[model samples]
Target: MTTALLAIDVGGSTSRATLVDHAGNCLGQGRNRGGNPGSNPPDLANAAIVAAVEAAIADAALPGLTIELALLAMAGPKFKAVQDQLETALKALGLTGPVVFTGDLQAMVASVTAATNGYCIVCGTGAGAVRLRDNELDAVIDAAGWLLGDAGSGYWLGHQAARAVTADLEGRGEKTALTSAILGDMGIELNDDRLPDGRPVPYRHFVDTIYAMRPIELARFAPMVIANRTDPVAARLLAQAEDYLVQDFSMVFDRELAGPVVLGGGIVAHLSGLQSRISEIMRGAGQVPDIRLVQDGSVGAVVLALRSAKVTVDEAMVQSVITSIAAHGLRARA
Candidate 1:
């Protein structure tokens, strides 16, 4: 019997679905809007999940494919109400197999490293870190959401950038390039009497331009700040962001733990400066272990699925799956 694997990672602003064969070969990948019920409406979240799953199935074009394992890695609190509703939605999409729902930490721990015990940090649209012990989520440190946490997340940085630009515009803070960069990014002009589109201006008329954007969209300016990091204001912002990340990393990391410290999420994984700074800090704390950046998390979910299926998870096998799934996901996005 040919068994298939279904992996879904649901975040605050986006959800991705990937289907793979028992052999760890990529089948199809689908992406949809935010599906976290805690962030979006319950109905909207459920619809996003079904849409992504169905799209992935259609893309695979594998008729009669029966998924043996399905996992949903979700953000926010795993309320029972949300889980029941999500499971109902999955069942409606024809997934009736053994389904599991994991918190954001469990998913990242599995995806970022092969180690059964270690630490994994995610700093994407939101931020948080989780400690893995014996391959289970042991302790989580403050990567929750923007309302109460997520100090180093994209949403947080974007929000900070907005505040900086606004302060400068209002003459309450020093001027910086971020004002023009943010205005340009939003298609608004700084110091303009009014919005060209008649929409409220960013700072002068209102913060409507920034307010109109989703958290993920605002995070796009993170790179802009990076580009202008030479400016004192931008450099200060980056410094603050890095400090928050280091503190978060320190919080979940047990110095004596025996596992690699894996880094995921856009801010930490892709940014070399941030990665180096975080590494230096870790070394100072004597918590250094293998530090690796994960390519794609959907591939990690497949590894866990393979484990549940009683397949051998070794170095070579894990590498092969990662490579294949990474390529497949790239093709999917392209």
Candidate 2:
């Protein structure tokens, strides 16, 4: 009997779905824009998720095939709500199977660490860390939200950059290339008309401008802070972000868990310097955590789905699936 699995990873800005076989071999995948329910209205976010999953199944040419299992890794505390909506939606779409809901960090751990006893730290559009002990969720230091937290995340870096630019424009901070770069990117002239009182505008306006841009494009600016890390202002911001991540992970380490720390998400995949800095800080706290990056959570999602179906995932099988995934990329449908 041929068995298929559907795996979904829902994040703050987008949702992804993958179709895989019992042996961890990927068959198809799809993605769509959708923020976390904590950040967006539930109805709107759930609609986007349903669309993404349908598109993936259609792209896979697997219509009418019975899925053996379905796994979801959703962001935010409202995971159960999202899971319920997804299960009902999938059933309406004719997918009958065993469904499991969990945090996005958990899926990253399963994908990268390959052990139930490990941790996964995700720093992408937002930042958060989670640890597992004996295959159970043991601890977490959530980013909360961009307004209150998300330190060490792309949004946090971009937000800081915007603040710096505004400060320099207002003559409150030293001028840096970031000021010119940001204004140029936004196509906003710092003329008198644009600045009514001939004074620099509020920092929130600039932050809004950054947010208005596409996520990937906006996230690209995060590395600029790292690139200019030597500058006191930039260094201060980066250090603070790194510190938050260290604290988040340290809280879990304090519990005395025996597991390596696995890192995931867009920011972590792109920011080696930041990860190294956080690792150093963790060491100073008397915790030596082994860290590695999981470039794509879908890889782990497939593994999870397969395991749920009582399928074995050996290295050879994992490598075969990974090689296929690499060729197609997580965003590409198999």
TM-score of every candidate relative to the true structure: 0.87, 0.82
lDDT of 1 by residue, 118-181 (tens): 8787887778888888878888888667667888777777778888888887668898998888
Query: Candidate 2: where are CA atoms >4 Å away?
Result: 1-3, 79-82, 191-196, 200-232, 254-256, 269-289, 312-317, 330-334
Q: lDDT at 63 for candidate 2?
A: 48
Q: Which candidate gets the maximum lDDT versus the true structure?
A: 1
Candidate 2 C-alpha error for residue 265, in Å: 1.5
| lDDT, candidates in the order shown | 0.75, 0.71
Over the stretch 1-334, how does candidate 2's per-residue lDDT look in tens digits? 3447888877767888887776666677778876367655678778877777887777678546667777877766565676687678888866677688767887787776567677777887778888788778888887666656677888788777877887787778887777766676676665433355565554446656766764434555676776676777777777777677767876666435556678887767655465676567557667675777787777777776777777776656656666766775644623
Question: What TM-score does prediction 1 earn?
Answer: 0.87
Cα RMSD for predicted model 2: 3.8
